[model samples]
Target: MRFQLLGPLSIAEGEDAVVLKPSKPSSLLAALLIHPGSVVSTGYLLRALWDEDQPATARAALQSCVLRLRRLFTKYGVTGSLIEAVPGGYRMNADADTLDLVRFRTLVRAADGAADAESELYRLKEALTLWQGPLLANVPSPMLHRDEVPGLTEERLRALERACDIELALGRCRQVLVDVWEAARRHPGRERFSEQLIEALYRTGRQSEALSEYRSVKGRLEEELGIDPGPGLQRLELAILRGDDLGPAAVDQAVPLPGRAPLALAEGPARPALAAAPAPADTPAAALPSAPASVPPVPLPVLPARLPVPPVPSFTGRAAERAAINASLTARDPGAATVVVLSGAPGIGKTALALQTAHDCQEGFPGGVFILAMTRPDGSSVTPAEAMADLPAPGTAAGRILLVLDDVTGADQVRPLLPAAAGGAAVVTSRRGLAGLVATHGGTVHRLSTLEPEESLELLAATLGPARVNAEPAAARELARICGHFPLSLRIAAARLLTRPGLRIDDCVAWLAEDLPARLSLADDPRMSVPHVFGGALHRLEPRWQEAFRRLGDQLGEHEGLLLSSGTLGGSAEAEEALERLADAGLLEEGPPGPYRIHQLLKIYARRHAREWNRSRTATAPH
Candidate 1:
């Protein structure tokens, strides 16, 4: 059976497509196919089906879909099981090569690295040949649909761009005119498409046509963005006007722009729409392969401007830590093809550290894609299948993107989205160690431990400065200990200090140590605490483990609880299994050499909440 998600979600049994019942199931199946071989958790499946408002029997619904999928597989003449039920979710048991999308991505990466033009062209063609239509076509899922449309659209654009690149490499600029012109007509507002068309026009000695195309694009930008044409296109126009031979070397030159982007040939200022071009009397407007004259004049829709994600601003401290991260990244080939797992308790700065590393290594991986997943209402992670469906295919500018999957306790749900080591690297952060998944994929793991005392002090100093922090060294140390040296707590504590400009360090420490429940109330920001960030992860734990977490907060040491909950503690394996679940959610820390502890702030929060519940019950009891 061939399952397609890179385009329309289709399941074909040999030569014929199988009919899928319950269209919702087909959509769900499609979402999984987008990231085939990845584990998709139950919670994510529900969300893809119902989002925030899950049906009463959501689990049953998901199981039904799985059943339908299995039946379809059976019809395709597959033997035993195609889907495997794993710890937290389901895994589609197939190699990457079996899926067309995976095959396409693999080919693209190979093409990007190829030295020969003919080989690169063949690779690109192979990649492009896999796409059938808009992904998840006819599917009625909000997240899946939104992602499917944009994601596949981006991939199609990339394939066209790469094809142009290969053509240019072989000195076939003139030959690209037919494809480029058609692309320009179809996507009139896409500056990249227009830029390539102009370049091809100029290279083929159609100087006037190239200048007219540039002017047309300029008009579109000015009308749309109220800005002028970007540097590369403008410069190309000048060179063409001056009769300068803008050979291969010129194409490689940077496009001058006000921003820092290396490649902005298509990211220039948006222009206003031009009056529709009049069709030549002799030529039909829209030519097609079948009946050239009968092809209708199709109006091109405006390409929405893709705003870039804001760059990470300079952050404070941990130079050595940052260097260590960069070293780990650079350790693997041209760089490591491994998934660097940053596991630690909530608010220990795992996400922050990973982001910083990603920021630092931005230059190395030009075409890298960065993604941050939000937790679902239920205690499961967002599935890799769903996430992959949403991610735009890597663009030329964003090549070899560093894939950072933050909050990755649900490895089963996300492992499919983890790209194989091709032209990119992946970093996954979790509260618990995903050793099994990492080992299975031959990936290297990096554990993000709590901050050191010195590092903690440095964080405070950065926020409050050396003078204020030094004024009360004892208070600083006490504050660090109270916060368990977790980066989130430190930042919050430091932020509070910054607000009260004249507050003493002792006063801040006293506030944190004492009256913290009352002072750091959820009244201000609902998600300002570690507990807030760990919502879904916490809910997913079994009841016994959840209870054990609360009870052990005051008693367990960091490593002790970690080992106990990570299934290493001695007992009937079931008890250890319970602990393992807690460890994965960032609720319990399982450090090296044994021991486990909750995030210091989380411990305090849960204890107080439990105490309040107990108090309320006692007060309301009838005598």
Candidate 2:
């Protein structure tokens, strides 16, 4: 199937054009087609469809639109393999040949490296012909407001400029002067179009008029962009004023000014910075053009800003923690980045809290939020240096900025990524306490623990509203209790209840009250169950700590009481250190000179790990 979005939205299979219903689904499908092979989150889609006045049934309505689009593909005899859902959103997988905009760019790149001026002019005009009218002329999509649209709009203008360059080379400058002047008037802030107008005026023997045009554009640039003109246009103005030479290279040098990139464009309030042009895949003997003499010194440095991933809507509680994180990261300082590490157990909401805080504090950072997942999906670690290489350099952009390092295992993993600039801040979430990160960066560390009983119940209510939970107060309390006030387990239980409509709180309570071994195998959730969420922390324990945790679990289960002293830890210093390590990791709660109690579910996980470790050691022991 071929999708045409360069003009009106249309999809065709073979030679037959599929008629799409003129409604939100058609517009929504058009929006998704803008960026092929990329995830467009549900949040963005909703905003696009509704602007600010979203309906209550927006999620369901959006899903219906996607379903209808897929059905339309099936109806047209094309397999519905084009669009699919990702974890957070949906993505379309269209290629360059099938998409008009992509084909246009390919043709432009071919013209950029053509051998002769005639062929270059031909290719440029061919590419320009693809645009029938203003982009997506008949499609009423909210997508026109997106950031990528300006870059898409640049394609036509660039093809026009390249054609003008070839025309000037063919001694047709006199024929293009009127068009160039009109284009320059329409887009006064664009340095290239204005430069073309100046060249045409100079070629027509209006040297003084060309100089006057350059002076006017220069003043506009200073007032609007807070910067001077680029080297290319400035040099052209000088050459015109002095009547440099009517040489062969005169056309090629029209827009190339020293100290700036040849393809640089003037940035306005709505426009992003223009990147240097890419070299052609297959180039001729003559190089296309030299890169910038150096990085173009714009008044404001370009920042590779990215949106922070948001948590699910059910996120609740942690009011104090959120306030603390916001206050620290948003503090007014002109020295070094304020580092705040959220140390907690696995599945204890550390990453979620940090992400939510980053979203909340986004307004404080003009450079925008930069989020890095410290661990890969397969569970391997990413070195700090590798992560640092992906972010903007320290002290490069303006205003406050945030760098969120999620699921960190060690301080050393994020050391290189830490900024030395004062206006920068980082929120690092880790199971292990990053004391060294705080010490080196002069920041604070907050140890995150499980929610309090009221807070845990509130989290459950946030997931399954108060109406349902209030109807079964006893069952709700019982369910929360069995989950040990653990945020991860409560969320999982809520999910089960959400999926099963008739299932009540008592059903969840019965599910949670089952024996540990039997329940672990029977739980419907593989991702957020008690053992799955809490078990990984056990394996992270060192040998001595593992033994202590296992023995402690055994004693707690056997009614040996909650408090442990030197006697229960086998009088071993290694065991004592291991117990403290477990406490610091949020697997155990620390107390003064006694046994540290753990959550009821955590005790079970510890006991399981302890028994497994002992069994392995015993099996390996000499017979």
Candidate 3:
């Protein structure tokens, strides 16, 4: 049986075609063929088929589609169980030789293992023959189509680049002249293609054109990426200028860009496409193999310029915290991969602080200030691998990058994206203190807290005019206290004041001070409410850590709900772990004198939950 995923979706046994009905189920089958031997998640399929607007009966509909696909395969072939259900989703089982994608990759790997240029070139040409047209061309799915197509294209591109390398190795520069030159011109940042083009131009008695190409490439790299050409590129330019004895094989033995990436067998797992490099005109068969003319240059698009998430509109007061982040991340440390973790409770302005700091840090990190918002809309987290892949591939200037990871859920989620060299900096904001990050490296943790009294006032004035705040000095002070000096609450209070023009500061304070619910409610916005904002952080905690949070909510000392001890918890180790977890999560704070404490408003919320736990336990008690 032969299955094709290189272009469209086709299945055949010998010469007989196995026709497939073009419906949703057939589309599902086509999608499965792209990632054969891998588990395709149900959620991924739902998004691929219907995009984000999934129906209520989406799972049932998807299952029915899968069963239909299974029946179709069963009817078509005696091949047992092509598609089967797995724990999380479905997997399509197929031999490597049966799928074109698998066969193409196998051929490329074989080329990489070949001992000589002739063998390598033959294998590469054979691999290129597998691509009939645009991959998955018939599928009407934006999710799978967009996500999977580019990777296949890149793989073909890599094979072309390798083929050119082999042709140059066998001293057949003229054969690939027009094709490789057009490729280098169309695709910048790829020094390998440029190197081949330069060598070919020089060998054909166009030394000036070769030198001109080098200058053009150098200027483009600096202008587009703020990077210098690699050392090998510089050396080539120097050799060309001085008329050094250069050979065609120099292009093949040359180093890749950045001079840091190893000459590995493969570039991670991505498969980038290549522009067709056709044979040059008037070239002798002895110098270059006879091939079709080069395909016209198709401009490869550059990655879009990253526009970072804008800072909060009413951002105010974090002088000390801002300085701390600046000192840790954007300081003049030449080759140190530093990390700074900003830990605090929910709605405490960790994100605001980190963002504001990044805005002021543009000069130091000329490479770029990239932010990856770590939390999802459902209050869950993006997997570490996905987050890592989403980040722009590090460039030559990766050393000067100031990567801001906002609202991180866990340390493991970011481990893959951490700077490999000690030349970059990362600013991580999370409810849980990522102690593992700093403990493993020379990073620091800045435990953020509620704004100081004066800072809180400044925030109010920043939001509402200074004239209004000055007019009601006493009321303004009272309101700041009532809002617990928390940034989110303060902003909400300010938002409310702006919305209701006739409302007074004193009236606002009194209304809020009326009851616990009133005190917590700064505005009608769900994100503004004290409980809702704090609940996001608390909801992520384990049951045991949550209990520990409840127990430590009230005032410290004798009158507190539960004493801080192993006797209250299960054992000494259990109590210690619980305390550490709460402290790390920023639920436990230091009291005025020195015992563990929580925010005044958060304390009330926690006590309520603790009482609920006790009540539920009492109600469900066995007779």
Candidate 4:
């Protein structure tokens, strides 16, 4: 089964479509899409759903989610339980391609070790082809933002490296000059790109231009890091001086340069001794944007300022769920239909599913997927219009375009990012329900949930190794129980096991039970944790609302997952207003109707602080 989590969550078995439930259920499906091939425990799932305040019937509700997913899979002729139950939770039994990040990583890995020059070039091209857009497009989950943001940056760098490699290997150094020039302009502080440009210049017989490029990079490096060029690069410059041909020679190729020792390449062609070829004045360097003469090595200008790097989220499990999501999205709708939302709580894998879905639909969206990540400043999500403004302007004839806007908690923030026409759909992800927005835009809202038991077990097996999983199913189940079926938690636990090869199943279970908080604490990384990211909202809340938040945090599961609602901490009207405020800030997630939960990690952090407040209250109480 090919799972699609790149866009709207969907699963497809060959040509068939898997139907997912709407709104809340769709959110659950997105959560399941994150892990792809691992088990997600029920506790984690419930906490994701309720944001720490699980319902009395959360178990049954989760079961219903599993049933709905299974039925959808069955309708599409999927024989096995795509959403299956395991000892303590569920898993989506599928492959990595169900998630775009996994597929992208796979291609990247392939490109990394590519041998033959032609094959390496081809592999790089293939790897680049997979990037329709940013991973998960617009949807930004803590689980995804933490992992995907870093991955995206790394992938971009990799793409640049491959492009440079191809240009050098193909002896098309002249062609890449303009591109590298632009890249340097865009990323002024990056010395690697500058190095590539210099190498390309050297290869093109422009020794002076190459030296100029080097000087620029050197200046910038000195300005930024207070250092000189590294040895490899200094060696390259020395090689150039010794009349060494800078053509596509491997690093080890022994080539004599003026005063330097002959460097050797493992399999490089011999370079001709010397040619007094004049620098091509009309070359790309000449075409580059001119600067005042005083600006030495202008091409290597220092960056204006450091760009803000958002947190990268890491998601675990949900291979099958992602496949189902992809299958459903790729499946043709009767009419010219578009617009799918992968909605779920933070860290529940909405973005992960969305990414897989987008990847699956790459062939469908020739215009390529445009992504706008919605970030919150303080407590409020950035508006849609603000996000949309950053996207490349759509062409007059927008054909087969997939636009993604992620983490849109408020309607206003989401409204601007949407495409003007309904011809091509925009896939949006959010913690808050967007029923009104969906109706306004003629879009489909799909809720995502956590994994099923079988899916969970499969994940455990994959993470812990099948041999160990098979021997201790009961232990796995108990571990899953403590994990709460959350993909992130499950992966953390599984990763711990993997790292400690000799870790026993029962020992893991015992550790979880004896120090559940500590075990869960280990799962908390500020970069990947939803609560940490969303805590900005708490800082912006009113004092009364903040107090109410603390109470809600302390009494999460026992209080029907109160979210400034239900008057558990305050009056109904006060609760309602607070809930709205929190939702707008992306701090609180809106569930089915009256239900609400904080983002999973946020909830834990919030509760921790809340408990501290409670202790303070006890101390302050009068006898």
Candidate 5:
């Protein structure tokens, strides 16, 4: 029996083929087969099966679907039990002989290790052929299609790129024209394919066509992405226009394949010849062409412009905040630079929002989007001078640049790093309100608060899947509320539930409510703990401010919405200062007028600390 996942979901034995009926079973089978021989977690399978609208009895329904898949396999004469029920989920047993995906990967690996160009090209073409159409085209699972299909498609395209490169190297430019042309057309934004298509056209004696292809791609990029072609594509066009030697040296210099070594082409006048290969490791240095001063030094390759920010796959909400930041970053005003400060409490998704905004507004900043960590991993602050060293030198990149100063400890730390050029932009994210930075630099300070109820639910659905969340809508909402609607806390809660597939939403809520801010941590990742995040913020406060925070927490217990007047903290001028300080640190939210309120989770955390402080004070008394 053979499982086919390179295209649509199907099983075949010899000439007989069968596609599992019903979308749920097909989705289940695809999920299991994707990770053959490994357990597909029950939580993942549930999400794949139902997406957002899971029934209450999803677990039982999942079991029924698995049983149906097994029976279908048996009805089609698939030998043995291909599907195995593991402890937490199901696993499909398959190998290169039984699965098309596995076979495709095997061929690609073989190509990677091939000694000759012909052998490598053959294996790559074979692997490419296995991709009949869009991956799992008939599989009706939005979760699978969204997450799994794109990566698989990317693998096929990379393999195709490698095969076409080899064909060009072997002086078979005419043969590769069709594949390269189709690929460039299909994926216009992918510059690598466009680069290859141009080279193939130029080598085929169609220089005008090659130049025209470059113009088309340039126009498309400017129209869609609002950016010019990358340095490599521009260089390739220049080389063609100069009518320079479009040899292996020029071609390789113009467009280098990532993760691929320079190809050694067959010797021919029409075909561009590769530079001389280095002598074998065993050869004596005296036999080489190097004689110290006589040997020309190799120039360092220029690195591409890229933002170091991590990908936020499950980022959700803050639509208004995102729009505000986008406008501030992308606003074109040559007279004034843009500096947007995102200030909020720890774990409120400050960095996530900043990075997402950077990615969204990347087109406006053509020079590059650079992210500098203003705080080190150990919680020490990064000095302004040290942070400035990470950015491009003054007036280097042609276009305007955007710098992201993340986790800033003070306004002073970011002052030196701010872009001096007009039209430049920077985004600063920190726990403290950095009002001084905004006051000095004249930028917008977006003080983030907890996410709205619907936004929090949307975040939970994105991470935990809509099926499980929608199954117990009330419990899910309560869970979000218990998490204080903070992005970090909600994410931690979602992680806990995801790791424990059998834990019910209401039961998890009960467990969290019993010992929140503490139970809100994942044991594996200490970074994901709410207590750790809150503790860090508390640690940053002075002793007096810390005491004020604890006392406020103790006094505000069980009544989260009760606004606190200055009288609650002795009604003195000093008391008002303390409240303002706490609010600035994001430990308190200043309500209408002079009163303030604390988040429910923060209140619980603060109360826990306040009791500890009181007990210690009693024990240390002279009595």
Candidate 6:
């Protein structure tokens, strides 16, 4: 007899399949099968049977459910003693031959041990094929579904991702398209799948469809999650647009196989020493004696440090900020490590500036340049411990290292990961002013603002060429003004023009002027969207500050270059504090003495939310 838990709970012997009629027995069976070969405690079984509403006879009721499951199994010709009443609990004795879930795991393990890509691909495909649908879809158990189903589903997805990686690596793009398309469609929120789908589509001679799919993904993400596609998806779109050579190597660089360390930095001409060297190959196996178990294991060799940051080829501004960062990082301070915190509004080019600086100062730090993402791809905070583990081992690099902690939420998140080595430095970028970090770490903070007008124009001219921007000089200036001179918005606007060669600057400016923040988004990249980026900054603030920002925008909408005092918004001291906090969060810019300024694009975003809030308030008001 075979038990299948990959999908619906069922029993099969030869060509016959059996389903448990009663929900209790099915739930009990599912609970046992979830931990096949291991004992599942009675307490857990009872909870699974009757979640939060256990009867006085719950223990006895669980036994009765187990009996019903056994009887059903026997009726279906299942072998004897499959469900054993172990001490304090029940254990379902299932092997690869008896359970599809067990078989799937066994196949995956075999694939992990497979000698070649072809063998691994075969085993992974076989493992994936066993998953018929959602885990235990027919088993009606809220407990099992809540706790166990998600993990089982993730296991299947990881396997599917691996299988697709192998297929792409093997140059079977056409073969991978069918599975990738379905995966991307079903899991639109998963950027990795979208990236793979885009690559597969592009590689299969469907470039336009690939670009369209990116736009669809960007739209869905914006509409559903109020965010943009991650850096990976954005980079993939740019690569496709450039018609770059996206062979197997490019695919690996773009998506990276899940669960592995990202590709290491190039070692240049000089190779660093390894942590441990291998034994001489000429030594015979019989002559070599293994070290005692008490002996410490040899550490693995450390590869060259690699920052996953992409180059900013068209980077144009931040001359002073770049010089300050370079001086801080390169200064020979043997007593303490340097920390330079770059705080700015979302999409104000903190990261771009950091990347450009790191590249420029690469020669100063002989140890290496490394990047630690403080936020996960899903936009959740990565714990400091996990971030530390992702770093190269201490003393692994040859000399002083430079670490870039990207998208940091707070000073505390960065404190533990700061380099302890003398002469080392860290460049931290965040949406909020990390004053606490500076207080503790003794570093300088550079608060980034919008680009200068000439700088913004230079960025546009650099990207779209001087001839294009100079042709319609006034229109170009208007475009920059509409973009609020924000680097990210400017880049998005420039990318749009670069793609559409024939679109006139004045016409583009007119289109953006109608709905500045909403139209500032690029179809291919979410991070470039004016509203999306500003929304993230707004969402991070306290509720009161968020409301204050929205209300302030509503009052100042389309009133360019206008300044509002805190007293004007609200007379209370709490209102003043809220305004100060909003300014710290980069949502509002502080004037010389007391007033606050909101960017034109940011004001548009705020006004929209303010209108929404007003409607919501009206609807919820007493009739």
185-240, model 4: which lDDT tens digit per residue?
55766666676676667765668877877787788789988999866567667866
**Candidate 2 lDDT for residue 352:** 78
Task: State every prediction's TM-score relative to the real structure.
Answer: 0.47, 0.51, 0.48, 0.48, 0.57, 0.55
TM-score for candidate 4, residues paired by index? 0.48
Q: Candidate 5's error at 572, in angstroms?
A: 1.7
lDDT of 1 by residue, 49-92 (tens): 78778888888888898897788677667878878889998877
Residues forming the 10-long window of minimal summed lDDT in candidate 2: 270-279
Ranking of candidates on lDDT, top first: 5, 6, 3, 2, 1, 4
Give the local distance difference test score of model 5: 0.75
lDDT of 2 by residue, 212-311 (tens): 8889999999998989887768777776677764443222323332212233223333221211212234677487654367734334235433433333
Off by over 4 Å in 2: 1-301, 308-312, 395-398, 420-422, 517-526, 558-560, 591-595, 612-623
List runs of model 1 lying over 4 Å from the truth.
Answer: 1-321, 331-336, 374-380, 394-398, 521-523, 534-536, 553-573, 591-603, 616-623
Steric clashes per prediction: 37, 5, 14, 102, 0, 0
The lowest-lDDT stretch of 10 consecutive residues in candidate 3 is: 270-279
Winner on lDDT (1 vs 3): 3
Which sequence of candidate numbers ranks them by TM-score, best first? 5, 6, 2, 3, 4, 1
lDDT pick, better of 4 and 6 = 6
Least well predicted 10-residue stretch by lDDT in candidate 6: 269-278
Better of 2 and 4 by lDDT: 2
Give the per-residue lDDT digits (tens) of candidate 3, residues 1-623.
Answer: 77767654556565333323235675687678778789999898888777788899989999999887778667666557778799988898766678878888898888776654455666776787677543554455667767877777889878878777665544455545634865675567678888877766665556898899889988989899889887667766776798754532322222231112332122333211112222354567788633335633333223233333333444667777788777777666676777888888777888888887877775676556767767754476755654554454555343366788888888887677786324677888998878787777658888888899999998887666566788899999988887778888887776666545468888888887776533565433345577776777777889778777666543243245422444444457767677767767777664223345567766666766666677888899997
Question: 302 in model 5: Cα distance from truth in Å?
Answer: 4.9
How far is each candidate from the true structure, as Cα RMSD in Å?
Answer: 28.4, 21.4, 25.0, 17.4, 18.4, 25.4
Evaluated at residue 338, the lDDT of candidate 4 is: 60
Please write out the lDDT profile of model 6 over residues 225-292, one tens digit for every residue: 99998876787788679875553222122233323422211133222111111224577888866656
- Give the alpha carbon lDDT tens digit for every residue of 1-623 in model 5: 78878864666665334433326788898998888889889999999988878899999999998888889878777767778888998888888988989989999999887766666776787677666434675567889988888888888888988887776665456445657766777777788889887876776556898899999999988898899998768877887798654553322233333236644222345334422222345789788665368535644323244433333545788889999899988888886778899988888899999988987888888777877777644466755655554466666665888888788878888887776435789898988888788889888988898999999998887666666788899999999999999999898787666545567889999998998778989776566798888888887888899889887877775655646777778889888888888878878877437578777777788888788789899999997
Query: For model 5, what is the alpha-carbon lDDT of residue 296?
Result: 54
By the TM-score metric, which is better: model 1 or model 4?
4
Per-candidate Cα lDDT values, in order, are 0.60, 0.66, 0.67, 0.56, 0.75, 0.74
lDDT of 3 at 487: 87
Best by TM-score: 5
